[model samples]
Target: MALITRGFGGRRRDDPNLPPGQYRTDDFPVLSAGPTPRISLDDWELAVVTESGERSTWSWAEFTALPADEPTVDIHCVTHWSKFGTRWRGVSLDTLLADVETAAEYVVAHSYGGYTTNIPLEDLLDGQAWVAYEFDGEPLVPAHGGPARLLVPHLYFWKSAKWLRALELRLDDEPGFWETAGYHNYGDPWREQRYQAD
Candidate 1:
């Protein structure tokens, strides 16, 4: 795993497709609030747990050694900018799921910054989702979610949890941090489920 760092800042680049500004949560087309979740764990929490409770942990080197594939796909942010032809690398979600035993109907993804998002098991198990370690053919920078991030291309970018830590299989659809706050439960980007349509 890449060493965790703070003070990572983002720069705005002129993308003909997006408005000119420092892109951030405020720039988000949809905004809402919710209670952030927290967890206290030791280094032993570093293991990946399969549905059947099989556990496997990886060091920085081992995690990076997993087979990687590049995906060139358009990325749509809930903040309203769509970056096209973005490339990412990491193990395919399907490949990772195959190693686990699960009867789950949903998934609750946990992140480092006490953020969580609930996604249907079907969505996560789909071949398109990935545990992305690289972006644009390079190791993903921290601000953009380095080490590993969850990529759910079909949903708004917030659904793509960054600084991912664990995947908790659930038997029910539990709203995550944003969902509980006001973001749509199923953030379908095409449907414009960016915020609660009040």
Candidate 2:
């Protein structure tokens, strides 16, 4: 069954991609737990380190110069809003992790704002995730994770960390901000896994 959300200013979309307990919204909402940070391209970099100690870093220009992919994916937020057909262009995690070998089963995504989120490595590889810079064919604005953000569309929006800075592969699971704060560890919206109590 799908929700017919026709009340909030006529947001009547009924897409199957929407998760339960969520309403379809044509508008994008800004949901950040802390004040948004202002990061400059010159000061930004992405560092990827494997559990076995393989280290790689990419400057802003180098990151953008990698092969890019444009993916239009439906985004589901744990806060109960589902936005469909959202578009983004970025370098896939596959491209970044291509030469790196990791036996780690999980990953921790760190943000410039000191926020962190943990995810399974399997969820990020094989074209499942990206470091997106453009949204809707435009340079992503800072407020919405401009310069670059981790785009993990399969999970709740928060897992797609804004202002992404580093990725550390872990052999064991390490809980992140929300995960430690009672949000479900693995936020699969389809299962209505919003809170840990669920």
Best by TM-score: 2
Clash counts for all predictions: 1, 0
Q: Across residues 9-85, which tens digit of lDDT does each residue of candidate 2 receive?
A: 34433556667788888999998889898888998899999998888999998998899999999999988988989
Worst 10-residue stretch by lDDT in candidate 1?
A: 36-45
Per-residue lDDT tens digits for candidate 1, residues 1-198, read 888544442234433433332243422233323333233222313345555666666565666667767877666776567666678888777876676776788888887767789898898765779888887677766567666788988777788887678787766778998899888898876666777772
**Cα lDDT, model 2, residue 55:** 87
Clashing residue pairs for model 2: none
Candidate 2 local accuracy as lDDT? 0.91
Pairs with steric clashes in candidate 1: 1-60
Alpha-carbon TM-score of each model against the true structure: 0.73, 0.92
- Global CA lDDT computed for model 1: 0.69
Model 2 segments beyond 4 Å from truth?
Answer: 1-14
